[model samples]
Target: MYLYPLLIVIAASSYGIVSTIIKLAMQSGFSVSQAVTSQFFFGFCIAICIFIFTNRTKLSFNGVKTLIFAGVFTGLTNIFYGLSLNYLPASLAVVLLFQFTWIGMLISCITKRKFPSRIELISLIILVAGTIPAAGLIHVDLSQLPFQGWLWGLAAALCYSLFLFVNGRATTNMNTSNRLVMVSFFALMMAVFFQSPEVIWNGTLFSEGLWIYGLALGLFGLIIPVYLFTIAVPKVGLSMSSILGATELPIAVMVSVILLNENITSLQMGGIVIIILGMSLPTILNRNMLSITKKSTTLGTK
Candidate 1:
């Protein structure tokens, strides 16, 4: 149990860091499609190598249906997210993507006919309030932001939320490594359709020194963290995993501040706190509810 949460935190932190590096890579001359394709390709290679080294056997392709589903959604999520970065700043793009929390909750309500708990409701409100500062919405000039960027960011959030929802259902029985490999393979196929082989083969697609960044991006950004999340989700369950995964936002802010020398205002810091509080509310309330239920059961027994 502890291991699962720990892994999730680590993976989330890595993802936050990777987003910044990817943004940097894009500024260094890589197109959105090129960056997405390169990361998936290298990530696939790394995952395959890990599979081979660990199992000492041919990779398993047992869960074809689930793999295909996961792969398609994952590919779509990355493509849209990469494209979103072209229109939005790294921090803003990430904040928008985090809207998946609300989207996921709405999905649960619609699909399961369940009302959110009181704590969840409060958390959701706080989370939305927090976004104002986290997104610099109050300070930034909305007129300066492109409408297309906002569309792409929202689209990315929806796609990512769907990816999480789909993967939650798909990986019921599959091992982590197998699921990752299949997803990467299919994502590679999808990316290839959009990427020009001429550019990639001629080595004209990436900026100088991008090979190193791309390799790191693949291994740290995609392969290891994704594999860890796949394994962690099964152990801790989706809701808890998602809640804990909120760590990525603050981690991203901190990473940007440190690595890119970006300044975060006091209002932005307040927003971060609110977001964290919102994310933690569900888990905290669930635990308290369980405890109370257990206490009542004990009293009734007595």
Candidate 2:
């Protein structure tokens, strides 16, 4: 029962480091277009390889169209996220992107025409509260930051939320590899249509061997998360999955600390603890629900 939620957590944790890697690529003089395109280009390459070896059920025409459409959200989210990294600090940018936690629940309520359950409401509030300090935003002066960063970051959040919503609802019965290749192919196309700069077409990637970054990005950022989420999201409903995805931010913080050797404030550590607690709410509730159901089943049989 908890397996799907655990998959979401694993996928999110792996994806959390993508921003740090993208930032490293940018600081190495790769353009956003180069980084985004290279990431998705290689992602599609991997997807195709997986699709070839994996057994896939024949898909309907409408399913193909829907997966293609869903791919756009994935592409836009990554592209805009790369753009955001250009202006904001990675921590701040991630915090902004995580605004999707609330945005996702709101989208669910609006589309389903029903309010979120009490546990979801409580988790949402806790996650938001924890998110602020986890990014160390309490120490930064937000007023000094450029408006464009906020705009792009929030836009990424919207796209990311939509991507999650779409993944949870669309053609889940299809084979995992089939959905991955279709979504990844269209996402690569979308990235290219965003108009990659000269770097993508030039020797910058091949000569300098920045293709290594693309390899890592493709494997870690796209391939792992996309494959896992495709399997997980349909099993776990949107609200629970959204909450589970909050693990990314804390995991990102830990990655920055370990890999980037960045300093973490005391407040940020506290926030990480709070975020973990917030993430645990659904799991606790689920366990209780399972126990209750088991008890009731025993009573009925008696």
Candidate 3:
């Protein structure tokens, strides 16, 4: 039981390390194509191994196809995020990526054809207001920073939300390991299609330091998080899982500051706090609502 919470923290920390690790790989002369491709390729292999070990039933082609559909968005999410980190400081880049929470809510609103609740509307307003300082746009010189980074960061957020939505709606009959293997397979395919065709043609998939970078990314970015979440979420429930997952933002920011030596302002730190508060509101609200409903039901029964 205690192990589950530890796993959650480990998963969150692993996510936090990804941006810094990518920067390190790039500093070692890795191209975006190489970095993204190797990460997904090695990740795919790891997923396949897990599936082989755990899968007992015959494979379901329908489930595999559904996961593959979701995999395209996941692939785009990673590619865009990697590009964003290349152009922006990891501190600022992570804040941009964290915008996915509100963006995902907006997507949910649009898809359901319903307006956001008052709480959600307020959260959105706070999120937008928070983004300015969080992005360091208010204090930093905007022109000096890469505009493309901002674009890619927001694009990554959109794709991340879309991936979640798609993945959630995908068939659930398949076991988790099998689903992961299928999704990883297609994510690797999309990585190759979108970024590294030339590298594939050049037959340089095994370049120096490729596996080292790939192993770090695969283990941290995909394997660890997925495996830990599978174990932790059912035990802790979504609310606690999400609150614990919030650790990712602070860890990512601190890692960047420590390893990359990026300077962040006080105003930006305040904005990050505000954004996290806004992002967490929905989960906290849901948990409270559930508690109130349970109490009311118990009283009625009495």
Q: Which candidate number maximizes TM-score?
A: 2
lDDT of each: 0.72, 0.86, 0.72
Give one clash count per candidate, in the order shown: 0, 0, 0
Instruction: List, residue by residue over 1-302, the lDDT tens digit for candidate 2.
Output: 77888899999998898988887787788777788888887898998888878754554345776787678988989988988988999999999889888998899899989999998899889999999889988856789889999999999999988888888865836788888888888898888788473555787767987787888888877888889988898888777888999999999999989878899989999999999999999789878999999999999999
Runs in model 3 deviating more than 4 A are 1-14, 127-129, 132-137, 197-207, 225-248, 298-302
lDDT of 1 by residue, 1-302 (tens): 25877887787777777667777777777776767777777878887887777665556677677677667766776777777788888888888777766776676567668776677678777777777787566766668877887787778677656655556664545567777888778867777786543445767545455566667777766776677877776576555566666777788888888877888888889888987887777767777889999999999999
Runs in model 1 lying further than 4 Å from the true structure: 1-6, 170-173, 196-200, 204-207, 234-240, 299-302
Candidate 2 deviant stretches above 4 angstroms: 56-62, 197-201, 296-301
Candidate 2 TM-score, true structure as reference? 0.94
lDDT of 3 at 277: 80
Residue-by-residue lDDT tens digits, candidate 3, 201-288:
4555565656787878888877777666655655654334444455567667667778878777898698778767865675577668
Q: Relative to the unseen true structure, what is the C-alpha lDDT of residue 244 in candidate 3, on a scale of 0 to 100?
A: 48
Tell me the TM-score of model 3.
0.79
